[model samples]
Target: MRKLKLQVQMTIDGFVAGPDGQLDWMWIPGERDESIFEKVIDLAESCDTILLGRKMTREFIDHWENVVDNLPDSPEQPLAQLMVNMRKIVFSHTQTAINGRNLEVENGDLTVAVQSLKNEPGRDIMVYGGANFASSLISLNLVDEYYIFRNPVAIGKGLTIFTEQKILKLDSSITYKNGKVIDKYLPV
Candidate 1:
């Protein structure tokens, strides 16, 4: 079966987003961090498909599409192209149709859909989630690998994906120059 990998950015206090979905806590001042983008490209290179949650689909797709269309000559072009070209499956009940190439909407059992994707012949699948989806996948124990980009700041109260306790074996960890840390973990 293909592995289902997940990448998420979270605060020091372990919240993925503020109560109002504010990401202001994650922004740093005057720091141009291209290394994180490089790391993202590295992870994307290993996966052929991207799985997304309903709430995350629009913003995520729009951002990458903007990068591909507007930043053709930028340093991020390679990663943008990869993101645009990769097959995307958004599991959404409310969003039945969205505009994009290589995109599909799935409103079925999450486990069944994910399992079927895992059984397919492919390199691996990458999942970008907005808290609830990540929580569900974590609760279901469907994630094989996790890449967490941890910011230095902490928000007192917010959304978190860890609905249940998980014992993780740390595979690797790195502290970026921008003060953001990346930790790769595998469930133990």
Candidate 2:
């Protein structure tokens, strides 16, 4: 079976985004690391399909498709192209339609949908979104791996690590000098 991976950039305090949904704190200001960004692009390429929550899907697709054109060419452009080309499955209750190549809208039981996708023949499925969706997947015990880009700064409070009703167990963790940590967990 294909693995389901949640790849997110989070703060030291465990918030994916700030209270106002701002992610400007993620990368260091005036810092450009092409190698690290390239690694992220490579990870994106390894995935066969992407699972997104409603908010993430809409905002990402819109920005990458429209806004990226006006911005100067940089490493972000390649990453945007990868997102456009990959097959996407957006889970949303309010979203009625989706526009793009190989994109699908899913408003049903997340566990069922994810399980069906995992059973299909392909590379690993990647999940990118807020803690709500991640919590849902964790509750279902469906997530196989987690790739967290832990930033240096900490947000006192914002989004949580997981919003699931049950507690999860961490299996292993790896630390990087860039003040990033990758924590892996096993579903009980």
Candidate 3:
């Protein structure tokens, strides 16, 4: 069975976003290090499927598509192409359908949907989250591995995916030049 990995960027204080869903505190183009972006591309290369929440599906697909279309010679192009062509399952209860070639809708039943996907023969699955969706998956113990990219800054209050407070076994970690640390963990 392929694993389901939750990859998210977190602040030093453990929040994924500010109180109002603001992400401006994160290091952007000016401060982003190439190695951190390369790590993200490496993670994407290991996954054949992307499982996302309804709120992020549209934007995520669009962004990757734009990258593939416009950045043909850039270092991120290969990952962009893979993301654009890879199978994407967007979970939503109210949304009945998704209009795209490689996109599909999974009813918001996390357990059944995730298990069914895991039963399939394929590369690993990765979840690029919206806070609530990620929290739901974590709370249900559905994530097999976690790739937490911990940035240097701290946000005192905001939304976090790790809501249930379960202990995680640290698998590995890498620190980039820009003070961004990627911590890989497994549920204990």
Candidate with the greatest TM-score versus the true structure = 1
Clashing pairs in 2: none
**Candidate 1, position 29, lDDT:** 74
lDDT of 2 by residue, 18-60 (tens): 8877888887765555655776787788898999887766677
**lDDT per residue as tens, model 3, 1-188:** 99999999899999998887788877656776887877888888898999988987787888888888887787778778888898988899889797754899988579988998899997899998989999999998899999999989987999889776799999999988778899999999
Q: Show how many residue pairs clash in every candidate, following the order shown.
A: 0, 0, 0
Deviating ranges (above 4 Å) for candidate 2: 67-72, 164-178, 183-188
From the highest TM-score down, the ranking of the candidates is 1, 3, 2
TM-score of each: 0.94, 0.85, 0.92
**TM-score attained by model 3:** 0.92
Candidate 1's C-alpha runs over 4 A off are none
Tens-place lDDT per residue, model 1, 46-100, is 9999998888788888988999998878877898898899999988878788887
Q: Which residue pairs in model 1 clash with each other?
A: none
Which stretch of 10 consecutive residues in model 3 shows the poorest summed lDDT? 26-35
Q: What's the candidate order when arranged by decreasing lDDT? A: 1, 3, 2
Give lDDT for model 2: 0.78
